[model samples]
Target: MENTKRKIIIVGGGITGLSAAFYTKKYFDERQIPIELTVIEKSPSFGGKIRTLLREDFIIERGPESFLARKMPIMTLVKELGLEDELTATNPQARTNYIVHKGKLHKMPPGLMLGIPTQLTPFMKTGLISPLGKIRAAMDLWLPKKKGMEDESLGHFIQRRLGKEVLDRITEPLLGGIYAGDTHSLSLQATFPHFSAMEKTHRSLIVGMLANKQKPAPSIAGLPEIAQKSMFLTFRNGMTTLVDRLLKELQTEHLITEQGVQTIVQEDGGYTVHLDNGQQIQADGLIMALPTQQTAKLLPNRSSIQWLERINYVSVANIALAFDEKEFTYPLDGSGFVIPRKEGRLLTACTWSSSKWLHTAPKGKVLLRCYVGRGGAEEWVQLSDEQLITAVLQELKEIMGIEAQPIFHEVTRLERSMPQYPVKHVEELRKVRADLAIHSPGVYLCGAGYEGVGIPDCIQQGKVAAEQLAAYLEL
Candidate 1:
């Protein structure tokens, strides 16, 4: 009898796709099932937004710099790939995070559980807010829970519970910096569901957070030493270390870069994936780890994922500059500072890379990464490289009073990369899932577009999608 091998194709060889392929292959290999797996990537490389630019004694991360250490998926993947020793934690002593207010950097109040102050003493002593602003924020303790099951904007939720000062000075910069989104339009439930849950359960967010903090830390059976370090972490070389490891593990034939999927047509037993290079791939199952827009193009039923077309992506740029330690007029003490949108500055945030991660800069020199280009402010990418650098330098001089020029500089622009989850985004995703189930059963979707955007979340999505596909195919 001729052997029958189940074929699987994963589109978009990003971290998500790599993860899906890894898990899927693991499942089939253990069962002694014959399988042919292929991963297609449109870009010249496999990592997608995970790009690292290494120069003379400096590691510049063009994309995400780190992942949350507390998250299990990325940690688990790292260990499985035997890259555990390479992992490094953020500088624990440099724990201070700042927000720019009135052209000055203010240390975030201690005991803050994601912008909500759990301790009263630090909250009261903090100068980030005015006297009236502090009084309004204190009102959160007595304010009744917001009524309604409907989703609301993060801006409205924060302003309602903690006051406008808290929203603008604390929550807006902190949360907006992560999403590169507008707080007034971003979804509370989708972005910070924990805050929403705390409000629903305890009525007062401050009280709820305090109560939660009092509880014991969650336990994991065999977490490594790296897992117990700081909140955010990365490898000594940069985040691309994980990507490089994943790429190395995949077979050359299994990994096909620079091949974009033009269209996917549903056949009797499976689907035919047409490539941009005039090649076609037939597979029993397909995993789409591409962005919302790219994945939408390959779907056979366009109307089913028409809502995906509405998924808006925000462009972001990172400018990494290196300087001698003595070049700065003032001390670069803290981890970094986030510029509030209210500050009306060209730079959104700046990370003291040298202070945050020792490996990022050479000895006796300082390195900083300035973030630019939020949702509506994407025009910064259009500026000439020199023009962009000049604008950033002007802002840095004004904010940090540093007049000296940088020793080295690099610019990276990620166009339409960050996805914005607006209010009612969960409901919209729910409908999209239902439509996919009806119109495209054997097809699967995962990545920043659907569930979550964090590295850990994307890994979890890939794992879940693989398990579901494996079960459906009875492998």
Candidate 2:
């Protein structure tokens, strides 16, 4: 145990880096191993994308609003950090989501799971589909399972199983809203393999969902009540609460803000990290908890960078507007709305934040958060704050019929935030791991790049990286 003392340096102060620091501290502290930890963050603040904006009486999230609690690591961390009471669920009534078709908002029909209709009545009534389109969708019930193929695009799978209407109207918008990705390029194996398995097993997605309707839901510990009620959750304050709590629990010396790593050079039996501000730190182990592109920059000669560079990212802007509830003709109901690419709207998705959680806004006030720009839509990303707000306001006027101006408005841009999971994503990840093993040693990578993209996924990757590092150090 005395020999287990090792200095560790973690790059990036996002949730992944923070989680790694916290878990590593716990492991070493319990084992009586003397460990020194340091976390370097590029931004002045530590939360990274998990930023919460408080203006007047309204609480706005600059980045991700919530996490899907179905993943265990996030929930476990929340409990470990004592944030259980601060967590809240989305409004129960807001469980339903709306989709834009042609030029109007239509309720996404119930019983559909990720664009695959598990029930018949809802699919038949969903106005997004034409009568003939509904018939093509229903034909999936009798159609045989797709024969063996290595992999297929989400676009191709949905078009073959449920028809182009479902892919274009529902699945595309829902998935695109989440991933900000094109269905034509998204891989079913990497994105949503459960649907693929359903097709292979029951020969029909509807039959599989129906047959499993009575099965008990999967367990997710330490999730907020709303998460137990459903699968997703957000804090009443914002996603930043999770990061704040983790930072509070960990030692201050282990964390550093506004210090970005400029480069990494191997030296002696360890490594030396050069900082952008002309400083260097030596560490027995290093964890690069950054996006793939940033990691590529630090490892110029590594082949892993080529594959990491091939994995592209999309920029996004989340515009939050606060308005009086009396101004809206239609009551702000449901979670929010998603715009299908076919609708040709400048925005991607909008969330009724005030409705999604309690205490998000003042009395009689409503907060609407609109997400815009993805893939090739750099025009929206480049828009001035005023221009972006005006564009979103005009769209809201036509879609939700809100005519009044917002009393308060805020805009947040996430440049290259979402990683594109193309059809070759799996191959790229595999190559990355193989290349890293052959080249970089005593160095590891984690975050939304190689694995899942959700908050929980990041936490899980961080914890796994910590365990692997601990094992390598034999701590």
- Please provide, for model 1 over 46-70, each residue's C-alpha lDDT reduced to its tens digit, 9 standing for 90 to 100: 8878898889889889988999887
TM-score of 1: 0.97
Each prediction's Cα lDDT score?
0.86, 0.82
lDDT of 1 at 197: 91
Choose the strongest candidate by TM-score: 1
- What ranges in model 1 sit over 4 Å off? 1-3, 302-304
Those runs of model 2 whose alpha carbons end farther than 4 Å from true positions after fitting are 1-4, 219-226
Q: What are the per-model C-alpha RMSD values against the true structure?
A: 1.6, 1.9
> 377-460 in candidate 2: lDDT tens per residue?
667756788888888899988887778999888888898888878886777777776676556666788988778888888898
Report, for all candidates in order, the number of backbone clashes: 0, 0
Q: In model 1, what is the error at residue 348, expressed in angstroms? A: 0.5
Which number leads on lDDT? 1
Model 1, 378: alpha-carbon shift in Å?
A: 2.1
